[model samples]
Target: MSNQHAKPPITTTNAGAPASSDEYSLTVGPGGPNLLQDTYLNEKLAHFVRERIPDRVYHVKGGGAFGYFEVTADVSQWTKAAFLNNVGKRTPLFLRFSIVAADEGAPDTDRDVRGVAIKFYTEEGNYDIVGNNTPIFFVRDPMKFPDFIHSQLRLPDTGMRSNNMQWDFWSLTPESAHQVTYLMGDRGTPRTWRHMNGYASSTYMWVNAAGERFWVKYHFKAEQGVQNFNDAEAKAMFVEDLDYHRRDLWNAIARKDYPAWRLEMQIMPFEDAANYRFNPFDLTKVWPHKDYPLIPIGRMVLDRNPDNFFAQVTQVAFEVSNFVPGIGPSPDRMVLGRLFAYGDSARYRNGPNYAQLPINRPINEVHNYNRDGPMRFHHSGNQPVYAPNSYGGPRADPQRYGDPSWFVEAAEIMRTANVAHKDDNDFIQPGTLYREVMSPTDRDHLVSNIVGHMSQGVESFIQERAVKSYWSPVDADLGARVAKGLGLTITA
Candidate 1:
């Protein structure tokens, strides 16, 4: 009115074209039924019906936050990762704590492994540590992953989870014994997401500038302190409040009580791995601290909660394949499988343009020829979409960096069992853990806990197999006690 052109009233429409009317649909007459030719009405109804997307196959229930990872100690000598190049260098990060093997609406307090995934928005790219609370996994090979997950999930016919199915899979796969021991112990059910630790179960490779490589594992020790609930307590919590873990995490952050974890690593010399006591690369096993001690690396603190749960938490994707220059994958079969599975799952769930989402997008500028897909928010703009075009499209930068190489003299690529090491036997560490690591009270609770859950399954053979496995690892007396508690005869 005052020399400025008056703006028109806003009108909603499909795509971008303005619509004159949205409340009423085009009809045969003014007061009659709507017609199919009503493009606006049809578009509105169509979109509203298909708004929801496919849910995640696992780690469905989760809590997330925004935070920073600061390099508190000197770890640059291990690798040339820019995030750990300097002390006090803070990198923006988003962390999601989840329960593995649960549905989207499953109870948060269920007795299952917790997933502690961190996405570090580094200058180079978004590096993800898609890991779990246990340092060891059920299977060392990827071919067994689907079967393992199927056992944990609901039965195909009855739509109910079966303890028989779970124990049968565990008993058959001897590699699962280490993780099964931990699962049957107190640590299986964490008290809360804030009080749990995380581990990169798969061994990774860290390469230095001198082309020297070392096998490493990442451990996140909870600064809030590790706490866990027994089987009964976890069940009661589920009935009382299914969202107890989620609420606890949200309330803690709301009260300005942030959570933190001290990042540590178990480093093994390259040559030492070749002659190690056990397979350093086995996902089903852990490297003893005596052989490879924990070295302090950095600190990760979750200071802020996500503003929107759906945008930041639900849509967040973590892939094991997201590695930086100095960080690379090892020959661990489980890890190699996940590198493909995680990324493939995201693409199927969120389309090929999933990486363009704000939560998944890296802090660094993405320069690629990949163009045109569903939900492609960003356009290359004036930049050419195809490579080798004389129009000055972005080209591959070879000088940037490359992964470290090692001499491999092995012949044939056929799958085979690991060459047994001096301490390759399964029962030794689990035995040591039960006898030495646990106190008298802890052992009593561990036995009681196993008996409680094992009673749910009707298969006596499965129970016997479980008891034998537990006993073989710890002590015959402990096994006998568990058998007696389960109302079964303990065979000497």
Candidate 2:
């Protein structure tokens, strides 16, 4: 036999035990039933069967890369975050880009919102900005989030997604109009992940060194410039390549054509939120640039592709509640809901010690009383497991590091809609977007996209109601155009 056909002298092993023959299972005779003593075969099959972990409930079809965030302008006055303090300071970060409303098997070019989650390994801890490509969302309150996602997913009986269900939910929830407007436009079908922008759609609180608080929104403007596929183009690309966006990102980084984004923040003074014309914390609405202009603070460049896709990309998790010093959650209902949900999801999917995973671990040492669970690779080594011990365990330092919190008004815990501000109606901002922000071409595309989606498998009553309640409220022209396209007539 040729030298290439010969096996190496080194023995192959299953776990730590040497396997005598990998190609054949141990048996009583040549053709006898494979014996139960074939422990190596059992081990191989067991490992293979248990390989896959639970996929994320959302944003499952995605890819990620390693990068660094460099502070370009001084932001110390607004935030005391160590990662964003000094000019030219660089903090390592990982960015995951994903398509919402789809599983891992779905096409990347689907007309869906993209998830843009970033994890910054700061000196303090892991800071994550769990956001999406769009600046706003379908619902303001967390109570309606599950319903909205359910509407987007397949129906229980038919197991097929229905536009009627989606329209019905949107028509019932007026606040969804703003996000619906954005979705049924060029912005929904971004040409590639590299060509789209990301927004920390939820409002967050930034505290300065002097304990002054501010409400802030994060925007990651793509340096490549925003580009998108029209409805027809998006459909065509789905047939061309299901993983087009993932491939584009990987190829670009491999060839040293790194993607970058500038970090711009819209910061409202803590007191200004109380008297703003509209609710500043509303997730379904955006703070007009005129009211609070974007202030550039830093830039992020994804220069390194993951060496192992599963180890770094799939295993990496970003929790919305993972805030370091100087940052905390705002009063946004969705943000508050996600503060618990994201971390809980990670723990359930990745085990109780998910933070101990290399991708999720912070650069700094973790010294805490929390002890072992499944896959607890990191141990404290006889350290006290409870706090307030005299054996020199880690102690809380209230003097040096203050809690990132603020004062709240004392009120009765009654379930009610958010306290409204002047000009807080759902239709105003969306109407403004349709009339003032969108260009003529964009307006046409938006109308077409809406008509195309609503005309597919939607009931006539749902269609009429959507045209009258949602589209008309957004803009009269948009409503009329959509109605005309859908062959429906509405009374003035």
Best by lDDT: 2
Candidate 2 wrong stretches, greater than 4 Å: 1-14
Off by over 4 Å in 1: 1-41, 381-391, 490-492
lDDT of 1: 0.85
**RMSD of each candidate?**
4.2, 2.5
How does each model score on TM-score? 0.92, 0.96
Q: Candidate 1 vs. truth: CA RMSD?
A: 4.2
lDDT of 2 by residue, 292-321 (tens): 999999999999988888878888889999
* Angstrom error at residue 359, model 1: 0.6
lDDT of 1 by residue, 51-111 (tens): 7677788788899899999998887678888888999999999999998888877788787
lDDT agreement with native, every candidate: 0.85, 0.90
